[model samples]
Each structure stands twice: as structure tokens, then as C-alpha cells.
Target chain A: MDARSPKRGRRRHGRFDVLWFLGVPILLIVAVEIVPMLGVVWISLTDYNPLEPDSWLSFVGGENYSRMLGDDLFWQSLLNTSYFALLYLPIAIFGAMVAAILLNQQLRGRLVFRGIFFMPVVVSWVVGSTMIMWFLDPSSGLPSMISESLGFGRLPQLLQDESTAMPTVAFVAIWKYFGYNTVIYLAGLQAIDSALDEAAKVDGASALRRFWHITLPGLRPVTAVVVMLNMIQAMRIFDPMMIMTNGGPNNSTTSTVLYVYRMAWDNLQFGYGSAITAVLSVIIFAIAGLQFWFFNRRSVER
Target chain B: MSVEAKHVQTPSRGAAGEGRLGKVVTYGLLSVGALVILGPFLWMVRSVVTPNEVLYSDSGGGIIPRQFTLDHIKDAFTAGVQPFDVYFVNSLIVTVIAVVSNVIFCGLAGFALARIEFVGRRAVTVVIVLMLAIPIESRIIPLYILASRSGLSNSYFGIALPLLVTSMGIFLMRQYVMTIPRELDEAAKVDGCSSWRLYWKIIFPICRPVIAAIAIFTFITAWNDYMWPLVIIQSQDMQTLPVAVGNMAVVKDQLRWGTLLAFSLLSVTPVLVFYLFLQRQFMAGITSGAVKG
Candidate 1:
């Protein structure tokens, strides 16, 4: 009451302002986000498809979820997503850390270097992934053309092959997204105390020792953030996979979200799609929650 | 804080400070990284202008174009199977609507959260944060149903609806507004300005930095978004740029690549131009995230 006593005039108009401001965004969020989310849960329990009115559109009680157990593509997509995560998580995190460390060294024209490095982050995924695909197209693309001209045989298809497709698309995504991670890491590096490094140098500590002790520990908080962001993004690797590989070459690069997209959009299997999405929501929720919980526990100890 | 402040003031720590060998190593590594980062865009540019015969021939992959032509660029606009012009206009319309909606809606919500002591404010903030956790993938099924049931499917409004405002935009704006001195709000009150007038005259101008940042983020995201547009616009005539490009990418053809690359480059040119103009603001917004987190 005491805190509220100083501003009675504004308080009279506060009701109208609240209705104007908070009401609109909250309603929009509910309509688009919150409602659709709950709708997914509701729709997942049925055998509903808007396209097929003749098909019984009634509650089937987890039939869609049960069906997923036998669905090879769903499982395969998860496996593919896991394979991608294995490549994406470490490379994206470590690549970004190294780039951030390099860019943070107070180097000349680091801004220019940073700007150049960050260019792909600004590019649309449809364009960026497609560009890489063009450069690597086995028959007519650069590597094969140049190789054949120099008396070498044709280069193998990186994208159209089962073995290399996932990794190649992973590389494309890493190239596009690493800059975002690097920028975050750069900020984390700036927040670290330079005085600690200077003191370590004065005490005859090696640069390696200074970095290992001070810099690495200083980056712990940001490391968790980058890891969490990449983990979630890696699982939902839709754009690059869809644009570059389309889960082709024996479905090597099909990601979970891409699978959801195909099932929901292409096949018009909204119920089954909602079931997949519900499952996906749980997995992502668990991953993010677990990481934050683990990181927070460690952070508390630190 | 002081070290970071020093960094902002003078962003360098130096080449001369290190020995010649260190300088050589750093510059060499930095240059390599930059080239690697830019290599894809360079390939796109080279292939976009090169004549198709040379581009597809044994000598196709050369860094320099063997023969130059403007026909491919013309084809990207006037000659492609998909109407690149329609895609361009649709994409522009969608992006403009999103940027405006996000700015106005999120800005109002952010202002209320930061400056007004409304009821359930804490609960609302927590809910907004929670909303960020719900992935777009998870919402796709019912989002589709919602679009069609609302009779907006195959329309621009349907494609841009889900993204008109986002939790991140609201959160970012709120954080920025919270940093602005509340004294301005109090002074505006003393001058008998209404709450909307206060926001317009005092808060809105002060919030320009964050406004620009959010608008740029919104523009880039709305411009690049492929999935929603893919689902919403069923008809080819109404398809956005990314959808058209996505379709082009799926076709397993070797001959039409010049057209493909040209369209892709054309789709990305506006973003590059916008970014170059606001590069400072763009990068600042990126760094702001990690610092706050």
C-alpha cells in the first residue's frame, strides 16, 4: 500500500492501459500458441484428419501414439536426429568456443572478421542450405567438375549418398548457426575478469594454465546456454535437412520436425502428426529442463 | 563490468602487443575462418552469373566465371516456373506485417509489464517465459487446423499469423524498457500526459535502440521462415519466396541449378542490404542476449 501511495493519478488510468497493452498480446498468444498447443494434446487422442471426412473422426484413445511404436519412419527419424545431434552438438559448441576465443583476443579487425563470420546467420536457411547443395552436387558441381578437369575421376555424391548425407547436411547447419553461438560466447568472454589472467601472468603462470583455470571456468555459464540452445535446435533440424537432403539417400537426413512436417502437411495425417508433436514436445521439454536443472545445480556449487 | 566497459570503448587489445609470429598465426587463422564462412556465398555469386554451359561443363567449378551472362538473373525473375515476382511481393507483405505487429503488440505489452503495476504482472511474465518453451514444430498440427477453420489458409494473414508476435520479442522489449529510467514516466505523468502519450513521447523514443533491434530480428526471421508458409499457402501462385525456393531445392535436376541459385540469391539480397545498413544494431542485439542470460 505504501509503495502504491505515491502515484494515485496514474493508478486511475492503469486499468485502461492494462486492458490495452497486456490484453492484446496475451489473447494473440493464446489464439496462436497456447490454444494450438492444447489442441495438439486434444487432437492427438483421436483419429482425426480434416482431409478425410469419411474416416471416423472420433477419440481413439492413444491409437496414434500406439501406431508410432510400429512406425519405421518415426523411429528412423529419431535415429537420424540422434546421429545429427552427435555431430552437431560438439562441433557447434567447440567450433563456436574456439572462434569466440580467437575473436575475443582483442585482435585487429576482429569486428570485420566477426561480421564476415556472422553473415550466414543472417541468411535464410532455404538459401544457405541450397547454396551448399549446389557447391557439392556430384555431377555438375564444383568439386567434381574441377576434379574431372584435372584428370581425376568424378567426385562422389556427398548429399545423395546414404553414408555422407547426414553429415553433409549437419555441416551446412553448423556453418549457418555457429556464428550465433560465437556471438554469445564472445559476450561471455567479455564478462570474464581480465585482472585474473593478468595476476596469473604476474605469478608466472603459463598462458595455458591461465586459460584453463580462469577463462574456462569463466565461460561455464555460457557453455550451458550454448549447449542447451544447440541441443534443442539439433533435434528439430528441419530447415537444412528439408532444403538440402529432403531425408533422401535412404532417409539418412530426415529429422524429427521434418518427419512431423511431412506427416502433418504432406500426408494430411493431423492426428498422427499431433501425436508425434506431443511426443516431441515431451522430449524437448525433458532435454531443456534436464540441462537447466543440471546446469543450475552445478552453477550453485560454483 | 569495468573490463567490459573498456572493451566497448576500445575494442582492440593488439597485434603489436604480440610478437610477429603470433600476429602471423592469428591473422592467418582469422583470414582462413573468414574465407570458409564466406565460401558458400562466393560460390552462389560465381555460379549465378556464369553461363550454363561452362557452369555445367568439366570446367564448371572454377572460381572465376568462364563466361558471364545476365540471362540467368533475368530467368530468376521473369523465367522461372514459379512466379518469383509474386513470391517476392508476398514475402515482403508477410515480413512487413510481422514486423509491425511484433513492434506494436509486443512493445505495448512490454511497456505495460515494465512501467505499469498491473494485477497479476508476475504471473503474466512467467506465462510469457513459459510460452517460449513451446516449439513451433509442436504447434504445427493444430495451427494448420486453426488457419483453415478461421478461413485464412492460402492467404497471407494465415501464413504470418502465428509469428505476428513472439514471447522473445515481448521479453526483450520488457527487459530494455525496465532499464530506462522510470523518472521519465513520472515526469510525463506530472505534465498530464496519458499513458499512451507518455509511451509515445518519452518511452518510445528512448526505446528506439531496442525497437530497431527487434524490428531487424523480426524482419530477418519473417523473411527466412519457410515452414509456416509451406503449410499455409497451398496454391503455387500465393507461395512465398522460401516456399518457392524450397520447391526448387526438392527437384532433383542438374540443369536448372543456375535458376535455383539465382532465385536463392535474389531471395537473400534484401536481407543482406538491410543488415549492412544496420550491422551495428544487429550485432549489438545478439551480444545483448548472452550478457543478460
Candidate 2:
């Protein structure tokens, strides 16, 4: 594109007028993403607290970083966030692939089923988390009702139990997010050269064999995308913990983002919050880069 | 590059779908998945119609309500945890305005990036891509500080500002615009079209598919956004639906479940409406934006 564009030179009325087009977007990006990003990095280094006087906002170097390292909750939240990513990644990627494959099968009312599956993708995590909290509430909710109906006593609290909370939250999160990966996989499925599968079939290849070689390999790009974005989102998870558990039942569900929000807003520990944010930003960038490179290399090797 | 609407409209390969047993298995599995997916949302609708007493009563064998009532739904507006109507209007205003700005700004920017030869063009693209890599949640602290400092806090513009023009929208438009033949620009220029006119007339009209993609994506993102609105909006009246309704997180009494459930249903209504009206667009837009990107 670089070589061809210069050779084929896009002529116009001096093209300078178009610079303003770039101007507005660039301005907004700088203000919203760029400025705040720099601010976050700066604030992370200090002991700034909104409630405190300006004197308290003095630069404290890497004190916030050392504090974060010493903080037990920071480590706990990091682990919880990592746990969430581990729980979310495989199930989400695999489930979406299966759902996509299922939807691709010629079935009655496939479009309606597509809508049914994709319903969660449109819903906010707020709506999802709020509804899931009630729907999964221990005693008076659906779980207990069904348990009692089956001659078992009331079901144990799902969200209230420390052991079950993270898994429960991750499940609901998966329910809300899997639809997106499914759509992506469906698109990837459609994008595959169907003639390969058809030819494989004509060669008497079994459905499993065809799917294993022709389908799965063909889906590498979307798979890379799905896995990378899903992991990043899971690591930065907030709504599930914030709305559902409030990082409670022994703070088991306290994800890193929820921890950041807690420190920054709830506890007014702005510096520590920004420190965590800076760390998270770097981690997200690293994961994204690794995944992109990994996927590109795989594609090149193939 | 998207191949969204046309390809999804027909299954290009469905050899297994042709088998009789495969049809049964497919429908059966899809039905189970559908049941699991739709269960909570359906229960939400059911709870919305059920009165508080019935919702709390032992007579209910399931989350299903034996009787239906509109009282809870009505209370969602009047007896909200926050100023429900105000939040609804705020979300509506913020979402609509943000979506409009996304289209205009991203349209111009996308066209510029794709077609116009300009300085810092590649740099802008790199920056947007890098922005996309950074998670929004990680940046909320500084976003809040900026919002408050700029006096956008507790204001609709504040709520909408950060999201007004998205990196995804810009990238979606840029990718789509790249597909537009340079001849369109050439011919338009030769036919007395200025740069702005070339964009407004030639590129803009041709970019409707991606525009639909951008519009729907931006609308959903803005409408469904919670973290930013939760951070920026300070006043009770300024809360968006998600923040407002979501704060009703604790219906610990179980009897108060109906109202919160009603609020949940209320907050989700607009999104459901979008899904119903533009079902394919939702699938196509999301598929292309994520997959192609």
C-alpha cells in the first residue's frame, strides 16, 4: 500500500482541507486517551489524593510502586484477575467456536438462533451483572427454588461463598461475552474457502477430519484475536465484581480493575490506583503484542 | 473485506446441515444453548411483571410468577434508586450525541487516513491502534480527573466526550475507505469536486456499509458503557441507566427484587430494541469489526 499509494498518487484539491478531518479525531484521542494515559502514569508515582491538600500531592517517586508490591490486596487482586483470565480464555474460545460451528449448520430458524445467542453481546455488563446477582441469589432465588423442588434443602449461596464467587462471576461473564467470540468465529468460518472443505469431503474425509484440518487451521486469525481480546478483557474485568460481589465474601471476586476503582475512587488512593493502572496498561500491551506476533508467525509458517 | 451481510445471508458450506440426523442434533444443541443463554433474561422479564409479594412468596416453585402485574414496572420510573427518568434521558442524550459525533468525526478521519495523503497520517493510525490496545478501565482514574478538571463532570458532554470519537470507529472507517477505489477520488476531483465534496459525495455515500457498522457499534458501546459514566457523573440526576439501575445491585430483601428486576428490564429495553430491529446489522457489524480488525 505504501509503495502503490505513492506511485498512484491520490490527487485532490490540495488535500489540506482533509487535515482537519484528522485534526478533530486526533484532538479527541489526545485529550481522552493520550492525556489521561500520561496523567495516569504521573499520578501513579505520587501519593495524590483528591480529598487531601495539594501538599499531599507531592511527587513521591516509586513509593507508590513499592507500596503496591507490599500490598496484599494488590497481589490478591492480580491473582484474581489472572484466575479470571484463565477461567475465561479456554471456555470462551472453545464455546464460541462450537457455537459458531453449530450456527453455521443449516438449521431451521438459524437467524433467530443467531439473535438468541448474540443477545448478550448487546447487553451492558451492568444489566448482565445486576440481573445475574438476583437470579443467582442464594435462598429466595431460582437456584434454591429448584433445589428445594428436587427435595434438597436451599442451595448454598453462589455469590456469597468465597470459594464459588469467582467461578460464578466468570461464568456469567462468559455467558455475556461468549456471543461476541461466536460471531467472530462465525465470520471466520464464513471467510474460509469453503471449496477446501468441499474438496476434502469429496476425498472421503470424515467430518471430524475435515473440521480438524480444514476448519480449525483456517480459524487461526480469529482465534488469535478472540483469545487475545478475551484475555485482556478478562484481566481488566470490573463490572462483574463491582456490581455482583462488590469484591466481597472475603474479597474473592475482587478483580484488578475493581481494585483500582476501589483505591482511586472509593478509598481516594489516587496514586496507588494510577500505579496499578500503569502496570495493567503495560501488561495489556505486552499480551497484545505477543499474541499478534505469535499469530503472524504461525500464519507465515503455515 | 467484511463479507458480512451477503455471506451470512447464505451458508456457503453446510454439508452436515444436509443430513437428517445432523439437522436434529443441530437443532437440539442450538436449543439447549438458546435455553441457557435466554434463561436469565427471560426470568428478568418474568420478575418485572410479578408483584413484590408474589416474588417473595413460597408459593412460587420457580422464578416464574404465578401472576403478572405492571406495578413494579411503573415503580421503576418513580421509585428508582437514582433519578430513573433523568438517567434514561441522560443515557439517551449521551448515547445519541456520542454516536453522531463518532460518525462525523470518524467519517472525516477515516476518509482522511485512507484516501488523503497527509503528514503524520501513519502516526495517527499507529496512535489509534495503540489506544485500542490500552484497556478503558485502566484509564478511568485519569479520565475522571480530566472530566472534573474540565468541568465536564456531571454534564452530558462530559459523559459523552471520551467516547465521542472511538479508535474502533476510526479504524473501521479507515479499513472500509481503503477498499474504495482511488478512481472515485480521481473522477470526483476531475468532475469539479473539492476534497470536502469528494468525501461528502463520493466516499461518504459509498461508505454506508461501514457507516452502519460504525453507527451501530458506537451506539452499543455508548449505550452499554458503565465505567466511564460511573466515574464522571457525580450528581444523582446525571447518572446513566446502567449506573443508576446497576446501583440497585442489592435487593437483599428479596421482596424488593421486583423493582430492581424491573429496572434491569428497563435498562436493557433499548438494546433489545436495537437487536430486534437491526438483528443482522448487529451480527454483521460486530462480526466484521472484530474479525476483520
The most accurate candidate by DockQ is 1
Candidate 1's error at B279, in angstroms? 1.8
lDDT of 2 at B163: 78
Q: After superposing candidate 2, which stretches have Cα over 4 Å from the reference?
A: A1-11, A52-57, B1-21, B61-64, B81-83, B250-253
Candidate 1 lDDT over B69-125, as tens digits, reads: 877888987877765788899999999999999899989998888878877889988
Q: Name the regions of candidate 1 deviating beyond 4 angstroms.
A: A1-13, A52-57, A145-152, B1-18, B286-293
At residue B239, give the lDDT of candidate 2.
87
- Model 2's CAPRI class is medium
List the lowest-lDDT window of 10 residues for candidate 2 chain B.
B1-10
Candidate 2, residues A81-174, lDDT tens digits: the string is 9988888888888988988988886566888888888899899888888777767765555766777778897777788888888988888888
Write one digit per residue (lDDT tens) for candidate 2, span B1-293.
24543454533446455567877877887898888788788777877787767766664535555677899878877776554677789899999999899999989988888877767778988987777777677678878877787688888899998778888888889988988887777767667778887888778989998899888888888998988888888888888888877677733554667777777788888789878999889877766656767
Q: By summed lDDT, which 10 consecutive residues of candidate 2 chain A come out lowest?
A: A1-10
Poorest 10 consecutive residues by lDDT, candidate 1 chain B: B9-18
RMSD value for candidate 2: 3.8
